[model samples]
Target chain A: MKSLKALNNPLSTGQKQLDLLHKGTSETYKPPLFVDTIEPTGHFPMKAKGVEVLQINMGKMCNQVCKHCHVDAGPDRQEIMTRATLELCLNVLKNESITTVDLTGGAPEMNPEFRWFVTEASALGKHIIVRCNLTILLANKKYNDLPQFFKQHKVEVVSSLPHFSARRTDAQRGEGVFEKSIKALQMLNAVGYGSGDLLLNLVYNPSGAFLPPAQASLERDFKKKLKDQYGIEFGQLFAITNMPISRYLDYLVASGQYEDYMTQLVDAYNPMAVEHVMCRTTLSVGWDGQLYDCDFNQMLEINCSGTKNKHIADFDLEALENRNILLDQHCYGCTAGAGSSCGGEVV
Target chain B: MSKSYYEPSDLGKFGDIKDFQPELAEKFFGYYNSVFQEGALSEREKSLIALAVAHAVQCPYCIDAYTSTSLEKGSDEEEMMEAIHVAAAIKGGAALVHGVQMMNKAKDMSM
Candidate 1:
């Protein structure tokens, strides 16, 4: 019940400290459920059918250190793919019929070879996607020209805009991030990215502990709200189910919110969403050139079987195609409600 | 960095702090209530989100409340188990990421 200012002052780091102090104050009190220690009943299902979507984790390096980022991406992270790995990925792109070459990262633009990959992929008529953390466009001078670069390539840019409001967005990201994001969005808009036909997709994960509202409904609401409130225009609003991980998990723990959120995801499990899970069609490749069933599994380091090519150099389309997918609790996020993926609702 | 922003002494100010600004407290409480209400979201949906959020924010009270709530809302044991796994993946990935910071620090320190 402390003032909202008091709650906001310390930031997430402060919240974590408060949790520790609170725990120590109540010596006789029994600890709450050990949500992290709870073992999952089923293992990750690893039956990968085919790699239609080629996702490349350009690196772990990013501009913003947001609260719910599953990748734990930040400027401090240096786990970037080397030029050698880039060549390997590009080599696979050459022989493979990958319709979509998804380039992701701390910020895909952070990678020195990002343009190289995008240019090559586009030349091959491959649909290229950059999982942009919009603020990155404004993070540095070198990146300021990204809007123009993206326009030239016609890359389908999927940017994360956690909320329309500055406060909510900044609460998840860092202070002033919402302002930068707005500026970046406006920049993209100027380039006709989020305008009528430029194909700029904005992603919106719930700011609080909840599954996103229905995709169609939420998108409609977002389009209207963003346009009316901020004069923002975008093609689609992708409501991604925040896969509980990393800093977000730490936030849940620090704020004593872990168990409730998990229960929420579990209770909202929708079986109809399973068939359209993005992993069914797309294959996620990590920074080190390793392969994963999907992006979530890649984040978890769950690799495909030994028979298949583990890295991009070993991009055996026949081998990776029809492999078993590895599913854990996070997979439910992709299968919950209308389902969620980098490209918006799966089903 | 300090692990928490609030001290045990701060809890004493909880109700009293809100007492001064009754309207703001009411607003937050109202927003919180509406968030949990079964409007577009079902009771089951609320519980599931509370559970996922419990993991995301790492709140014990929220976690405890939603766990039971999810079960009561007819969530099966397996579904609950999977949600935890999602939490684990995210948590684990985040922690492993610190290795990059460590590596950076080590390189800088060495220099």
Candidate 2:
């Protein structure tokens, strides 16, 4: 059996990219293991406890081509959920006390059935979170009304904004992406998505080699500046750490930042932040309905237990709850410093 | 002709070696330094860009370092937050365009 790493080759770009999907920089660049004697600068619990948030990967259809995406999501991917799989999800939602439904993908909105799922979840009174890539709203005519749609259904908009500068944003994404993202954000604001008192949330992750700043303090700064400069009002700013996976690992390997970056994460590992790690409370569902310990694990193809049904169709809350987490060095990222997730600081 | 399947994951072995093929790592490091160097962009500017690029690429370590570096280099909160959207857009768009491949294949098979 080929260990996934056995399949990689530095010379081939395609192989390199695929390898990145499974072995984020952590595997290759060995960071010092988190030693207990060193007092952790930031606080987080040592072990993770499960929470009731239900995460679902709608599909792999997206509109942007950023460099660091972990999903390997693109327009060509066909691994979408069938109506049957979605039905299984709804059944679980009805029976389970799950409070949050997190929808992801290559811009989950690209799914043909995205709205149907969102509407169904809303009807069930579940808090719906759409991990939106803001520019999608401005890419095509079909997506023009997404802000209105999200607002109408009261779906919490967890959108990403890499930075405030046009040059930096455009370089990472493409030429005109900054202008378009701003337009879409303004649209969301117009529809009350980011206006004060609205439930709109903007996600922030660093652009380069380190952990994020303290979430609360960062959010304060974000709120004030966005409000003052662009009049872009958002409810909360989530400072998530970028997990080393997929294209990102490729970027790290290609640019030789993999080792130093991994070292930084391991050095910053804080056990106190572990308890609040999103994986403890959240169960990530893949596009094919497979169950993963967390989104990062899913990308690595580490599914729930050997005997359990990994797909959503086979969702068993009790069985999943009993399964131990699948962890690795990448887990350090979630436990470092103040910790990071879609909701800001974990600890 | 879209190569369709180019993944960096193929290069996993390079990182596994205790002492990497220094020449190779050096090459990558060189490109990296060049990417972040002060040219049209300042080191501070490059750090912010790197932070957003880190998210676009999804490297947790880069995310951790660049986030702090960006802030340290005077990137305000709004600026850093905005950089993430840039990553999201490119990532999302990359996924969406692959649909063209699917569409082409579907059309070819149908025709």
Candidate 3:
């Protein structure tokens, strides 16, 4: 499928003014404004506790266009990060006390400077995480050796496998994705992933409008099915709630499910989940070297609030740590039910 | 008077039953919530059973609630459909098994 950007879809470039759905009458059930909803719970003007994870978007050039992608990333995108930006990121890591550097992208591997950044970041003694879409490892012969490369760098390999069933997974991601994902997972296991401390994790988001299942039970099911059927082993299954933004927001609006889906998100809000939101510890660097509160904020052009020009070159940790996390209706996605983050359910 | 007996929105008002009879509703909900927790049977197992029971009674609200609950508890399409089949078989069997009584009564009426 072509990306929203490639198709010239309204939701693609127009997301800067995306609606947060804070509307309704006093007599009716309007989901309360996300910021207001948190006030009673003592999270008014949510602030970042610290920055421990540096999530860098290598670029928006991915091989496949999954339906729920927030990045609107696909092969048509030309926004690869330049070597200068990556060098600046490395310099920041060298100076800051930040511990982990997470590499993500259309597919981070698709970035020309991807390997160079990984090698450089690994050299800094920084824990590295690569948000690999498993199919990329099998997309081309040149990309086939990524598993071995990741294993060497001690990079935590996190890939999305929406469902263990091919029909369900492919329905959401794309045709033949489940087959290729299984093949790639087996490849990772062959290199000792999911064994000892190699740390291979799979991510699951619901195929449709519903929230993801309980993380522990779903992980058990994923482990048993992958092991018993395809002889694949994965360490953890991160159940991330799909945020209503970009391609996913487009899906909700087009399917006539916008109100129902938003209602579900609002009604299921959990205050405990807010306390562990990924944004508190993570800073997202966009492909163009700009900084965002989180990846979702980056997608929506919601930059860090404390500074005027919050770019990676600036690298103001103290300012960013104190900045109020910019909130929107989309944030309900992160705090819904068990809560969602890069590492899965926060609560 | 919205004409339809089952309003999808009514499911959200399931808690409003407390406004009518708070003590009884509270006790029932306490029991209902605890019944679904992981115990002798895993929560997944209980969800499948609940899904089957929802189908057996043919309650629209229950069918909707349990269908989503079953999925949330990690029950897949195949397992969920299988649970429905269990409900179907028992319901069908309840009618067919009564044939033996009819057969005996017919014999009693034999000339």
| TM-score per model over all chains | 0.67, 0.70, 0.93
Q: State model 2's lDDT.
A: 0.72
lDDT, residue A197, candidate 1: 54
**Candidate 1 lDDT tens digits, A89-199:** 777777555788888878889888888878888888887888888888887899999999989988888888877667767878889988888788889988888765578
Candidate 2 segments exceeding 4 Å error: A1-29, A33-48, B1-111
Best candidate, DockQ-wise?
Answer: 3
Worst 10 residues of 2 chain A by lDDT: A1-10
Better of 1 and 3 by lDDT: 3
TM-score of 1: 0.67
- For every candidate, how close is chain A to the native chain A in TM-score? 0.85, 0.87, 0.96
- Candidate 1 regions exceeding 4 Å error are A1-46, B1-111
* DockQ per candidate, 2 decimals: 0.02, 0.03, 0.57
Arranged by DockQ with the best first, the candidates are 3, 2, 1
| lDDT tens readout by residue for model 3, B7-65 | 99899899999999999999999999999887877788898998999999998998998
lDDT of 2 at A313: 72
The local lDDT score (0 to 100) that residue A2 gets in candidate 3 is 89
> Which has the better DockQ: candidate 1, or candidate 2?
2
